[model samples]
Target: MSSLVPPAPAPALPALLTTVLPALESLTTALGIPRTVLASDEEIEYAWKDLPRELREIPAPLRGELVARMCVAVSTGLFDSAMNYIWNAAILQLRAKIRNFGVPIVAQILQSDFEERNLVELQDSRLLELSLKLNIVNEDGFFFLDQCRDVRNNFSAAHPTIGTINDREFTTFLNRCVRYALADASSPRGVDIGAFISAVKGARFNSSQNDVWVQRLSETHDAQRQMLIIMVHGIYCDPNTSEPSRLNALDICGALNSGFTASLRSELVHKHSEYAAKGDEPRHTASLQFFERLGLLINLNESEQHAIFYRAIERLWTVHNGMNNFYSEPPFAERLLELSKQSAIPETIQDQFVQVVMCCVIGNGYGVCRAAVSSYEQLIRSFSPREVALMIGLAATPATTLSRRISSHLSCSQRFKQSLTLIDPASVPSSVRATYDYYTR
Candidate 1:
């Protein structure tokens, strides 16, 4: 046989939602629902089953069928139907929860219908509103349900709509169902501070009970705060605690809070005050240092995380300021290396931070800035060719001391030199030209 490369296999087709949410197909068949009436080439199919893994407990059978139908409708771009299915699921879940208690809850749910239209239908919006009152849904979960109902009303299968649903809209619709309507388990088990702190103090993983402890830690604020208190208390607690326990505590710490900065900032500031007031700055230095360290590891949301990173760099810069003073030099130099790892900062802020590092420290003629520039290996490596050109463009301004200091730092760093060479020297900043010349020579 001739040696010939086989052709690449045909791209596999995406599975219909039936494969992902089998209950949906079965439900549709049982209800004699006609999904084909709305099916079209524009219907963008995505796997729906794995989309909402935060789901704690699946709904009862009747409600699950509705949830599955919602999943299928959303994945296939039948947003109008998706809304109705989600609404129906919400109603069923609420009724089931209430029926377990009594008619008082049902009476409350139908109060709005009885008051307004001489009828009680357990309406979608009212049922969701009552779900919030009953604490069946959190604030965020309720917001999603309310929004789903609004979209459902305007683009419902029972009525004509002036709007269209894209993938994003359908994704939102699908999420409401998964998060609120089908979710049955809302409370975490009884893992609290005493358990967590005692475990950590004793050098145990608590991993065997992680399902209970981790979920409890992840879900409850009281549990999270207790965990944080222990993490902070470790600084003051018995040093008999092992390093492994401390390291593992950080993994738990990273998991506990939503806003990394917000959660840790108060404790950090308190530590700073306590030490700084007692003339024990060195004892407290670790708390301040934790910001630079832990901020990197936290699982904060994107925008807030980015803001915290920028703020952290600026704060470190303020404390260090490239002064080369008895208190500032070596420690500041070390912290500056920490700055180099903050590559997630947007390029706009990146340039400004670099400029500050160059001008604020080296501008004062401190060897620390010059030495620190090379240590900014991660930061230097992050600079794009275009960014290097922008740095040169800065030289186009009048040759002030700030300009010269930036130039001097540029000249001193071998990393920046390599990045500069990647772009045409003519593209460099006009004010940066002489600095480039002086440095390159």
Candidate 2:
């Protein structure tokens, strides 16, 4: 919950190094070993002087036994050994973060059965990847920690040394380990996914139950919350889900809707599109309904939007041409109007959308659908500039159904002119201004 504050420098570090360095030199001399085999005296002193500042960067909770050993190794000019110890400390900190983030939740996110054994066996690189995926580490942390992992593998005593690192290189390595992995203060509490799912599926949540779950979701870390949102969406879109469960999902998602970030929205869209791509018709239809229920239809891609508008127009057109057409048309017309209010009609479908709505408004040789006139007027008044252009240009295309009707039926032609009057002059594109003027004139 809180970041560890840096403690004062270890009082014994300078004196301990002063004693250890001479004895190490004497032993090396007695053994007839080259002094160059270890860090030079100047290098050791430079590293030792800089070590305190870097040590202060490590959180107090992170300066464990391994970190103490790393400081001792550094004092003796065993930079490689120091690297190994510090890297161990960093790795341990990352593992602890994963454990605290809840292993089962991690398993859910990975879509695999990850456990303590799996956590323990993860290679350094994979651990970093998981950390990034779970938002345990930000991108910068992942980059630097991955580099540190490579350093531990190649340069540290953990593996055969590829090359010697300078005092500066060692300090840089220590700093990255401390700054990226060791210094992170957040202790993200994991949600109990088992209990969460059971509750969601068990019953319709009352207001109090809803508030509690919402609070729990709000309290979890971003990665876990994001996953839970997606899961809830799946439940909502599942055709076999009980009605109460569906409403439960909706209540939760709707409450949290305002807090949805772009990343969250993108994930939902990806899942929705996945259903369509796999030809999962039931889930796809339910997904579309989900979006519509949440009023998130605007987040769908252009092609999806075009399909939605196209289907809606087709339904309205059918009702307009059927028995009891006037009464039946209003609801379909009103639904289409609601959809247009949700987002701009995709340009790919705009011409068709305009043609159908205008045709419905002008009606057949019998009469206009008076009961649906309000819905039709509302749709017309809300048309975008491109739609306005399409509407005006329909008069020029006499071969089209609306233009044909406008020419043949006096009432249809007059109603078409009244529809033109509903369009705002500002929304008429300049390219269609002449056509608009010709129709109105």
Candidate 3:
């Protein structure tokens, strides 16, 4: 939005200067944003002048709003406050001067949004500073977490282009881009800090409280409230904390129940196994990534020394919790079997496995192919021809095309046939058959 609402002009230059000087002086203090990192007003003026001729005359009203927005954005930054204030002011000035600057402005706006988002995320890292202390209140404030979830949605809406990306597409794109970042050991730690923040926000915790968490993290480090600082920062900074923070708080609360942590950990493992039993690759990949990150943090030499030992324990807990369901849910159980086979031999190359799996899931056919065939067999045994045809159509082509694409580009063997055999015919519902048939033909 805007910086200062322009002071109404007086009759003459000297008259205006005499009356307005103190207000300008007071404005600086009232806004509380300083010129510490701000460029000279002349530089901001020059930046405005250098823009396209159409953008030269930004309306006074719009300029004021833009400045206000920048002021709010700046207060959070130490070095960045002034720089961003000037930079955002420049961008907003340019934006205000246009009729249809959508395409031209998209790049700048998107970039600004990203920077702001990342900054907020960086702030969130010290969440203990931002998180509200759970005092003994009359009501459970679950709404706080709900608010955070809403903010996450807002961020997603602001960047809908990214939202359009499917899981596999995103993974592929990330792997490619992150390769350079990961390889460049000489790169600054700040880059990784930015990257790590982006990754966390992108994956978990959607809400305005999340925004609060980030804001507070950056603004305060109160000596009197050390636990608040550590708790928020620990969760936000820790690479393994994927679940929602509200849930995390609830879990921590249950720790007062003595055996709750063990019970919760067991429940977590059962949930993971359920995902595996049902052939949910997305959840599977998430589990693998979670453990892998933990494993890396823990000692690599000793089997029991992983920093993320609890995550692995949780994974195991899920397996044991659903032992009975494992038999009844044959396809689901087989998913674990498959995961166990694929992940049997852990290596130092975590990224490689992630990339390979990502490649296997995206575009035209690769990931769904195996699942489709297995579902198809299950369909044939239990459903009518029309239903089978529908499902065949739905699942078949994409799988085949994915198979062909990967086989051509990456030389990886396709597994659609194997995946098909694993599905139980009784699980193939009739409407699903129509979807299968449409694609199969």
Candidate 4:
């Protein structure tokens, strides 16, 4: 990847208007209009279909003229006119002939345009690159933003396909749901609370419905659904609550359910706030945790779903600190630990989350930070020798200096000696125990 720093800021828009806009206007004035107006969307499409042929037959000077003329249309608020030629003709030519059409073509286009006259006006190289990656301009690409009617018609007509949902709408619903939970007028009575708790239990395996209901709750200002989720969790975590009661059972499940749900709600809220506070990073870590929580709550067992969770978290930890740091916030870690102790979380998930955090520490350099070194020791102490040995092998290859530092610390630590001593040669697999022996020695 290129290491070029972001360009300086654009001169004020007025300066841009005074300079490039007028040059563009003069160029357009010189070209004048063709005999007929390409006014409508259909006419624009027809024009685009013919453009490739014209571009081929015309000389490079004339092609440049057309590009300059089209720039005027784009600048002058002739959206359809501009899009017709460039989006269909120029963009398609590059997409078919160019190997990596997305970023390079976009960069070239931005560079050649009058828009690039100002040093700071250019978009980030990475941002332009990623937009192409996600949009998939090649034949095999999944997303296309072109305004061609055929493409739109095909997409709309495709059936039995996974429907798309808006992150903004889901997040809006989540915030409203969380707020409603805290806004109930009075404390619950036993029967009403019991029924509420039952609904929370049902919600665990019905999370998609829960999502829709949360949106509904937001739209209607009805706190009933959300309040029940929080209420059941609160009650279930209370030791004094009767264990066998239906409400208690609901609370136990709901507590775990809300633990995951609430974490996502908080994360999305944090991200939304962060983006508003600062500009977006080119590569945003996709939140697999949010989807994983959804999958678990909804009883989804697809392998791809599982892979998405793992991949998302892996990419997340890679880009923005470690997984432990990501989840170590009080509400999440505390609840997860509580769930672990209470036998609410499945053993597999517990192992997965634990390993993920440990691996993230290795990946992101968290393990080697002087401040976190002691915390790393405390972390290893919390794990059984068996689990620790498993982690050592899993981290055979360290991606960052922090990971190497962690390896060094473990190799030298007294705790490592004690942990190694506890690794029974007979009970543990030779491969697992051998990894600990090799690392510590």
Candidate 5:
């Protein structure tokens, strides 16, 4: 192999400045402008020495027309103009990032109608703020970029210069712009809302399609990912949504479940609560189903959990008391067991939950629903300490259906004892140990 050759070293800073600054000074003098109007030779030399090294950090593709203009401004010792050129370039790149992140998503996040014109019209300060909110620039990036904005406004040629920035200050400003705005050229592209919605709604996502969409969501900015999650939840909760679409929504949400941020979880809970607060029963029911399907009911408040568990218990109890109870009870029993597995039974509903489960397990005089016994056993085994206590004391509450069944039927009493044995001994409270032994014995 041929030997690798090192490139030539850059020209000396003094030589470069000497060659360019004299011509610039002669031009200013010929125009009768004070020589003091431009940066001194020393400042020019300082900037020149740092310029090549700094520009090397920026990728070649980014060294476009505006960068060329910035270089020209620096060579002539017009540091203010150079600052303005670089700042404009940074602003353009930031706007491009937002555009690639999708304007509609920005609009959704801002809760405003943000078009391309609105984007173009945003003040530099407002743009930085929006960038922070969108996570386009992280906190550190935003901090420095905001300072750069202040510099552009106060000391750069973009506006009336309140003060002059020396070559060192200009280098710092350039470094901030490049580091915060231009350096991360590989930032995630925004997912297109229209295409995403269409794909989700069009058909069931196969494994490959699921992986692709999941990866897209994983790679997107947090703000967009959050907004997309909300939209998917809405779709899943929509009564008119197709079965395939609903499955698609569930698939996407389930894949991202483990990575759900606190803010995102809060948003979901807020949206879910809104459905209840508005008395939107269909949507509320669908929202509950969405949470249940994803095993996310634990994220809901206690009151919400109580409502869900109570309704499920009521449905299972009704089915147990109806005709063909044996055949009908299994599915309802299985559903309630599944719900209980999702979270602890809420304190407010624990008594009713235990009463209904015990009633079903003990059955009527005809005996327990055989097919449904396993579900009831699983649910009993999974009971929290409080639930175990409720269950142990349930037989002592006279005139209740479960109490009457256990008192009147030997088989029912024996089944009730068996159900109590499913509860882990550790879950039995010390205070309830005597009562738990009485029930199981």
Candidate 6:
């Protein structure tokens, strides 16, 4: 593992760093970073004297703090510390852009690759490269960051250095650091969630093509697009859609369904957790409610959420469409069953719920539901008695394969056997009754 702590600077270095740190403080002003990130307890360090004039690129808000630290590092010949400052400045920019506190947004940009290989941990260089893709840093910025990585590895405090970075090279790296990693500027105007929400709320759909927005969204970098998607999702679920913008927002959401259903499912638990912590929750509203919304917005982590989710599942369930196998898969279904165990389901639509479960039991499409038979069994226990009773009647009416599968599924349920007393021998066809008997036995 690469060590983050730099080796103690040479014994003679402290006094030099202490003296120059004070002198540099006179060069420029800086709004220092969090106290925790301070490299030394010495007096506030100064800004770069000749920090480059060009290199208008990604904005790093902590430029003053970074310059101070880097100056202290290079002045004292603490090459490693200097590199660490550059690397951290990049991280600070990413954090500022996404509002994510830990694990740089680069990790998310490369989520699929990292997850596939189980590379849960990443190094600074790889993260910097991935940042290019995220637009956290541009392609040109990536080249300078790559050089910074090399210099930091070879000359910075993190690892042993056989070579030295002299004043000229150190200054060049500092300029690159300032330009690429710590440009002190605001983000370029793109998608402002607040402004866009205001527009949506006002129903500003004057553009002939709503698809134009989605197309623009598709063309943007993934990180920015994802940010917009998340913002729109929040809007789509907002409780105060009493304005015209709500319709405009819904139109945008309908247009931007690019694999977002699956993404939304993945985020349900976290989003609910967010809503739970907030003071204002929209419990009574249907469309705008956050944590308590039914349907695709359900949070499986909260047992209370399942009742709403399953209720929506029933409302949306048709022979043509159903829950898209998110819960039918094993551990997820187990989680669903556990959450909904004591859930109060309406008796009127109970069989509809049972029918969906039966669809899984039958594995009509893929064997997705087959992976968690136990979860489905527990779910069936809620309305299976009524459904099995109906299936008993359906079984007697026809000898068709679909009816037989229904009969077979009913016979497969252990609860069905114990509830057999609910059915009369006269109620079902003689042949179907014998078939049920054979399966039960």
Per-residue lDDT tens digits for candidate 3, residues 78-160, read 11232223333432322222212222222232344333333234332122121222111111222332332233333222223
- The alpha-carbon RMSD values of the candidates against the true structure, listed in the order shown, are 15.0, 6.3, 23.5, 24.8, 6.7, 17.6
Can you write out model 4's per-residue Cα lDDT over 201-259, one digit (the tens) per residue?
Answer: 44343546445434433332113334444344344434444544434334333334444
Worst 10 residues of 3 by lDDT: 182-191
Ranking by TM-score: 5, 2, 1, 6, 4, 3
lDDT of 2 by residue, 127-153 (tens): 999988878888999998888888888
Regions of model 5 farther than 4 Å from truth: 1-89, 102-134, 138-144, 157-160, 165-179, 200-211, 238-244, 323-327, 362-374, 407-412, 439-441
Ten-residue stretch with the least lDDT total in model 1: 111-120
**Model 6: what TM-score?**
0.35
Q: Candidate 2, TM-score vs. the true structure?
A: 0.68
TM-score of each predicted structure versus truth: 0.36, 0.68, 0.19, 0.25, 0.71, 0.35
List candidate 2 segments past 4 Å from native: 1-38, 45-76, 104-147, 153-163, 211-230, 254-280, 295-303, 314-338, 341-343, 355-382, 395-427, 438-441
* Model 1 per-residue lDDT tens digits across residues 1-441: 799976433323346544534545565678898645443333454324334442223534443576667665666557678768767666666655544433442344344323323213667676667556545566888887788778777877857886766655666666666667665633322233445666655554556643455565555434234534445445432245466665555556555534444545555456545665786655544443444455542332344345545665676567555344435444554555564554355554656655544443343434344445454443544555455545655443446434665456654354334435544665656655676786566
lDDT on C-alpha atoms for all candidate structures: 0.53, 0.87, 0.33, 0.37, 0.87, 0.52
**Candidate 5 backbone clash number:** 0
lDDT of 4 at 235: 43
- Where does candidate 6 have its weakest 10-residue lDDT segment? 43-52
Query: Per-residue CA lDDT of candidate 5, range 1-441, in tens?
Result: 999886434433335545788897888889999988899888888887788776766766777899889888888889999999999988998898889888887776677799999999999999999888878899999999999888889998878988898999999999999989986666666777878999999988999999999999999988779989999999988889999999999999999988989889899999998998999888889999889888899999998899889899999988999999999999999999888878988989888998999899889888778999899888888888887778777787787887888899999988888887787798899978997777766
The backbone clash count of each candidate, in order, is 8, 0, 45, 1, 0, 7
Off by over 4 Å in 4: 1-332, 335-355, 359-389, 398-403, 407-427
Q: What TM-score would you give candidate 3 relative to the actual structure? A: 0.19
